[model samples]
Target chain A: QKEVEQDPGPLSVPEGAIVSLNCTYSNSAFQYFMWYRQYSRKGPELLMYTYSSGNKEDGRFTAQVDKSSKYISLFIRDSQPSDSATYLCAMGVDSNYQLIWGAGTKLIIKP
Target chain B: DAGVTQSPTHLIKTRGQQVTLRCSPKSGHDTVSWYQQALGQGPQFIFQYYEEEERQRGNFPDRFSGHQFPNYSSELNVNALLLGDSALYLCASSLVGADEQFFGPGTRLTVL
Candidate 1:
């Protein structure tokens, strides 16, 4: 199994809808979890980061990490067409800094 | 202040040729890392450079190599590239031992 697994979603939703993207990992040693958003032909931008297990909120985005289940999620509220992009989940052991990444989920917030 | 910057936004090369991509880190950052993102896939770690030395490498073969300069800029060189070598090459910079990383727009390489 891949170290990190995410559904390669092309999920489409209407504007103002809430969107939830998730990923599961096999390694329990992953101490740092991150979410990145990438627009077409652009680099991945860091959206949110969390250590261990907890919930972090940043404006319209909320990130949740569940260490027990080895799962992580990024929730977007009041989605916009500008929010359309690929969301990637990344994790790593804090000491090594070598992140294992998921394939990314493609989300589109249609108008 | 400029974020991470990569050169040659797009490249087209024939198989068996070589290509070099460059990256300049953001100000005050000393470490540089390279990754390869294939179509419809996540970025895979290539290797990392710090203090002008190779600190760590991923599972990539020797054909993939890199260098870090005193100024904290970096270069990724792929020798005798194969068709499979075609992908979006991304450069990331960060402070040493810092978990957060800043990325460049990436160089899109097409091995024809």
Candidate 2:
């Protein structure tokens, strides 16, 4: 199995809808979890990062990580049409090793 | 300040040819890393350079190589490229020992 697994979603939702994206991992050694958003033809931008198990909130986005279950999620509130993009989950033990990445979930917020 | 910059926004080459991609890190970032993003997939780490040396590498083969100049700008060179090498090449920069990374717009390479 892949170290990190995410549902490759082309999920479509209306503007102002709440959206949830998730990923599950098989490695227990992953200490850092991150969420990145990538627009078409653009680089992946860091959206949220969490050290371990817990929740971190930034404006309309909330990130949750569960070490015990090896699961992580990103929740977007009051989603906007501009929020359309591919969301990728990344994790790593440290900077010494390369980060393992998920397949990414594509989200489309319709107007 | 500019976040991160990559050159030759797109490239097309044939198998058995060589290609070189360039990257300029975010202002004030000293470490540079390279990744390959296949179509419909996440980016895969190739290697990272710090202080002009390769600090770490991923599972990529020896045909993939890189260099970092004293100024922190870096280059990724793929020798004798294969058709499977077609993908988006991404460059990321970060502070030494920092977990957060900033990425460039990436160069799309097509190997026919």
Candidate 3:
């Protein structure tokens, strides 16, 4: 099994809808969790970052990590068509160590 | 205030050819990391360089090697490339011991 697993979803949602993207990791040593958004043919852009098991909120994005369950989530509120992109979850054991990434879920907010 | 920058935004090569991709880190950053992202997949770490030395490496083979210059710019060289080498090569830069790594636009390489 892969160290990190995420559903590669072309999850289609309507404008202004709430979107929830999730990932599950098998490694217990992960302490830093991050969410990145990538558009087609572009590099991944950092969105939300959180440390350990807790929730961190940014403008319209929220990142939550549950170390006990080895799960992480990113919630998007008031989603818009401009929000269409692939959402990737990455985690690292240490701040300076390499990151393990999930396959990413593609999100499409329809107008 | 420029972010990380990579050279030759796109490249095309045949199998068994060698390719070199370059990256210039953001100002004041001293570490550079390379990653490969295939279609429908997340980015995979190749290696990292700091102070002109390789600080860490991932599971990639020896054909994938890199070098770091005193200026903190880096180069990723792939020798004896195969068709599987076709992917988007990314360069990320961060300060030593820092948590946030800024990424470049990436070099898209196609091995035919």
Model 3 regions more than 4 Å off: none
Rank order by lDDT, top first? 2, 3, 1
What are the per-residue Cα lDDT tens digits for candidate 1 across B92-111? 99998787899999999999
TM-score of 2: 0.98
Tens digits of per-residue lDDT, candidate 2, B5-100, equal 999999999999999999999999999999999999999999999999999999999999999999999999999999999999999999998889
**Model 3 Cα shift for residue B104 (angstroms):** 0.7
- The local distance difference test score of each candidate is 0.93, 0.95, 0.94
DockQ of 1: 0.67
Q: What local lDDT score does residue A30 receive in model 2, on the 0 to 100 scale?
A: 90
Top DockQ hit: 3
List, residue by residue over A1-111, the lDDT tens digit for candidate 2. Answer: 899999997999999999999999998889999999999999999998888688999999999998999899999999999999999999999944588899999999999
TM-score of chain B of 2: 0.98
Clashing pairs in 2: none
- iRMSD (1 decimal) for each model: 1.5, 1.4, 0.8
Question: Residue A26: error of model 3 in Å?
Answer: 0.3
lDDT of 1 by residue, A21-88 (tens): 99999988889999999999989999999895889999999999989999899999999999999999
lDDT of 3 by residue, A1-111 (tens): 999999999999999999999999998988899899999988888898888688888999989888999999999999999999999999999867799999999999999
A80 Cα displacement, candidate 2 (Å): 0.5
TM-score of each: 0.98, 0.98, 0.99
